[model samples]
Target: MEAAAPPRESRPGRDWDRITAIAAVLIGLAAVLVSVYTVLLQREQVRAEVWPRLDFYYAGVDGEFRVSNKGIGPAIIETVEVSIDGVPVRDWAEVTARLGLSDPGQLYSSLWGAVLSPGEHLAYLIPSGQEAFAQIRAETQRISMTVCYCSALRDCWLAAPEDDGQVEVDACPVLPPERRFQN
Candidate 1:
């Protein structure tokens, strides 16, 4: 048999090289995951900062029907819908006429395209006298209002008298001219 060759020398640090490469890859992957999670958390924090809430209130004693922005952010009113006995009315004037309160001496504010800052309120309808207040309060059972508003970030919600609370919406519906509330 030929003389045995001198024992071949094992390469130094061969195993350590593979281990180091795998560790580097794992570390990079972990960093990427952490960065993605951080981005998602920041996005959520931004949304919460500008979130808005709109609420409807009626003060029979004060003869006022108001809409308030109860959240920390401003509410941009998109649409207002008022109905009497399930029939849509174009304005507070029509509502008074339907209620048989001719010349109710109402002071009203337009709701369409209004912007209410945090804690701000708009008295959409205020009757001038006690008699009108009593009549309006009594007939409130037959009236309903639905309002749609958006936050500064464009997140929208629908506030309805019949709903338990406001409902989130992708966007506000576009009402026909006849169905649109002028006030």
Candidate 2:
């Protein structure tokens, strides 16, 4: 060539390419961090909702036959069902009639409206001199109860004498307010 060309100089905006690339990497890192935070929060919420454990059992402590709650949560009792020889007794009236008792309340005082905490129970003590006492003493009756209860979180569960035992079910029911304290 007749003349030598001047050396080619880089554009003034050459630094802009590096700045754009850095900005993209920063945005991607931010997105990943947010995703991880969301996953951790969801895990915590699931653990809180399902951590309570409840169990129902029949045991003869001393001479008393008791239905007990051995759970960590507060059970809000909604309904109770008694079964004899696998036949379900629908109501307290039906059981009273079957037992030939004048009042069902005289039989089991704590069976209804029981708000059982851990280590709490309702006793089935056979009163002496009653004709029903003989049936109980003979152990001829296989009396068992299924309780439908809920936790403070409004999660419902069924405590039954079935082979599968207690399980989580629908939403907890809303109950009437408890009695007022006299003091």
Candidate 3:
């Protein structure tokens, strides 16, 4: 029979092995907790960036074409450039001339503003008579516009028909800039 091997001596760090393993597990758990907390904070940041939607659209009321804002937040208008039939319009006079809106001067004369808040609207009442409105409607075609605006936070956006029915936003600081029109 072979002689039995001598009994092995206990190593100095043998007990430390269990302690090191426990420490490693605790460190891993702390790392996971940190990652989870950071994710939660990021989610809140994303939510903050996506609110207060602003938009522009047309509404017909009492035989009038109204330009209105339908957003929850106030939109500080930076510019309002409208083109009809591929021609840029500076003022209502140009719009009247280009649209051939016969005898509809009174209401159209006062249409000028760079800023529009939610639910606030500007109207261009089609001349008092139905017959006059008919002529303007037939001649109006291919209306394109670019309304550059900003939020109270200075978040800029462009409300354009060419965006496939969507709003374009940018973080660039465009505030304190000259507005294209006066209210």
Candidate 4:
């Protein structure tokens, strides 16, 4: 019939459908990126919380001992008590692992030692040429050292001995490298 006059030509472009599909894809991608960013931030925060603050190193020589403190804060290595292989000394302290600051050409003559500041270092010198009560072999003997240091940030604690009397450290970072004599 003449009234059917051609149903209005169906709209030519599917623009609305295309636009809706594009928006949906963009929203999904945005959600995925946001989730990934959140996960990475959380991982970084966890790693920063668990790191230890101090670094301890040691070295041995025929008569002197070198103890290094590679820590962020100033450290006081008070009274390094040395017992070889867990055998406590019965008489006069048989071991002499002393600490001191050293220069490029010579060692400081101060009899006692104290705080090692950041980047600044010191060393422990065991008086040279003395017959040790026990044969001090690098592989067989160890230095069980206890250091009492107060952190610049106001925390004080005693460090436990790393090696329970087994070997000696020839170079301690707390002291200058020139002062270090590797054994």
| Top lDDT hit | 1
Instruction: Return model 4's CA RMSD, one decimal.
Output: 13.3
Please identify which of the two predictions, 2 or 3, would achieve the higher lDDT against the true structure. 3
- Selected candidate, larger TM-score, 1 vs 4: 1
Which of the two, 3 or 4, has more lDDT? 3
Relative to the true structure, how large is the alpha-carbon lDDT of every model? Answer: 0.87, 0.57, 0.58, 0.43
User: Arrange candidates by lDDT, highest first: which order?
Assistant: 1, 3, 2, 4
Query: Which stretches of candidate 2 lie above 4 Å from their native place?
Result: 1-63, 83-93, 96-106, 124-134, 137-144, 162-164, 172-183
What overall lDDT, based on C-alpha atoms, would model 1 receive against the true structure? 0.87
In order of appearance, the predictions have TM-scores of 0.84, 0.52, 0.56, 0.36
Please give, for residues 1-183, the per-residue lDDT of candidate 3 as tens digits: 999999999876568878899999999999999999999999767545533444433333455655556765566666666677876666555666777564644355233334566677766344555555555555555556566666666666666644435455674233332423222
Candidate 4 accuracy as TM-score: 0.36
lDDT of 4 by residue, 117-167 (tens): 665534443433333312333423354544444544334444544642322
The clash count for each model shown is: 0, 0, 0, 19
Ranked by TM-score, the better of candidates 1 and 3 is: 1
- The parts of candidate 1 lying over 4 Å away from their true place are 1-15, 162-164
